[model samples]
Target: MVKYLEAIRKELDYAYQVEMPQMDDWTEIDIQPVIRKLLVRIIGKMIVGNPACRSEEWLHLGEHFTEDFVAASIIMRLLPKWLHPMITNILPQRWRLRKGLQKTRDIVDPAVLRHEEANKKRARGEKVDEEDSMLNWVIDNAGKDQVLKILPEIVLVMFVPAAHTTAMAISNVLFDLCSHPEWAEKLRAEVTDVTNEFGLLGEKLPVRDWTGKLEFLDSFFQESQRMSQPISITPNRYAYEEVIFKDGLRIPKGALVGFVAVHNQIDPEIAPNPEVFDPTRCLRKRQSSPEERDKHLAGQPSKENFAFGYGSQACPGRNYAVAVLKMVLSRMLVDYEFKFKPGDSKPKKYHLMEFIIPDPTATLMMRKRK
Candidate 1:
């Protein structure tokens, strides 16, 4: 996961150079589409490899499979319980998913077969491409015979959670920075100081180790997620056995349960002026005490912040997600200036079921800094 930060940085630089080669002045961009494309490409490269990630078919499948999967899940839930089977078969979204999966298989299966063949040769003391990708890792562990059977599903599973959520997190952080331009300069100052101290910004790969030293950038993302939670609730669980809380609250077996994350995040007791967006909220908290340092990091899912789920079941990719976000945002701040479009103070968020979606229509003005 850490190694991929370099890939992410390279992709970001490549996208900006290739997509906006002629930009000389402030240009307005609906950057959501651009960010989404960058993520698909970066993540595709991480999951597959060089030439495969560049494939239009592979990119399309990675980008849209989640949309199709979500649409299908929603439609499946809307139908009567008994009619689920019948409705699923007839839904266009289901057909779209099937088509997407078939395309995914077409793109992934050949790669898996080749990796399997290479692994066989290596077993007999022959050399092969040694880059450790998700596909290669799976082939090595799950064996050649199981590669085709399991590779597509594994790729889809890894790609699905990352596709929209990470993109939205980056989008919201950009929105917050624009809405509060004060923090933008402050964040840029931090990045500048860190990069100068270590000469990190000029490196070919993201300084994954230095990310921990990026206290302010980490806080900015934490506060961004705090006030603009992508998911309303997390650590959702099913009661497999009758359970009772210390307060005598009893949950029956077979019941679904979860936590309301925003309530704690916005609680005045936990965060004074919770309604206000304070980029330094967590950074300050981390500095306040030794034990409290980890308490407020974005990935730490305490009782107060369930953005990344909780306990042993927390999202495993969260650390990688944060690393990618900081890499992107820090590079963004260092390379360009950004502001919300005139007359647009802040973009309104929409909810789809329990997820808080970023405003897709918002445009941001950007220009290279001289």
Candidate 2:
């Protein structure tokens, strides 16, 4: 994942310019659709490599698979549990999910065979493309017989979560920045200073360390995420072996258990003045205490933060997600000036059961910084 940093960085620098219009004046733009497209392309570059990243079919699949899955989930949640088995057959979203799965094989199967051949070439002491896409890396590391079984799952797992979640997160961050316009200049200054240190004249991708230097930007993003309250519950689990608690409460062997995520994010004890939007809150803690530093990083999972699940089973691709978020925020802050359209402030978010999703119809006006 660490080795893919440059590829992720490099892809965003190109994707943003392509997806975002070069508006010279304030323009009414629906951002979520654009963000959805931008994330798939950038994430695709890391997942499948060059040509596939730009493929129409691959990009279409990457963008919509999650939407169908989410729709199916919401529908199932609305119906009784016993009816789910019956509902799956008639559900349109379920059919789409199956169609997408069928299509996944068609697209990924050929790519796997190609990368497998590349692996054999490298084993024969032959030089191959030095720029190893994640496909190549997965093939190189997996057992020979496991290649077919692994690649498609890897493609779906990697593309769906990373693309969808990061897109929502980046949209929330940008929307927050627009709502509180004062922080833009400050975050932009941090981006400017860091990119200049890396000798990037807006064309080159910065190394991981360069993105790390924008601590102010990091804090702002973390705060925005906290305020967004993206999910209501997470780190969901089923207790396979239940036992008695110290309080004398007992749970049966099988039970669904999970943390109430919103409680953690907004708990006053955990976040001072939790109701207020203070961009520097996390940064101040990071600077004041060594113990808090690493735990508070944007994508890092910790005991209190539930955005990325904590511990060994934490979201494996979080670091890559954070890197892309930083890169896109850095570029957007530097190249564009944005604000909500007149008569519109922060667009209200939608709630579906435990999920708090950014309004898909949210719009903001943005123009080139001149």
Return the top candidate by lDDT.
Answer: 2
Best by TM-score: 2
Q: Residue 180, candidate 1: how far off, in angstroms? A: 0.5
Candidates' C-alpha lDDT: 0.79, 0.81
Q: Which residue ranges in model 1 land beyond 4 Å of their true spot?
A: 19-22, 201-206, 244-248
Off by over 4 Å in 2: 201-206, 290-295
lDDT against true structure, model 1: 0.79
lDDT of 1 by residue, 158-256 (tens): 899986788889888888888999877788888888878877753633557667668888888988888889878777899999998999999999998
lDDT of 2 by residue, 66-89 (tens): 889888999998999999999999
Q: Compared to the true structure, candidate 2 yields what TM-score?
A: 0.94
Could you tell me which residue pairs clash in candidate 1? none
Query: In angstroms, how far off is 294's CA in candidate 2?
Result: 4.2
Residue 173 CA displacement from its true place in model 2, Å = 1.0
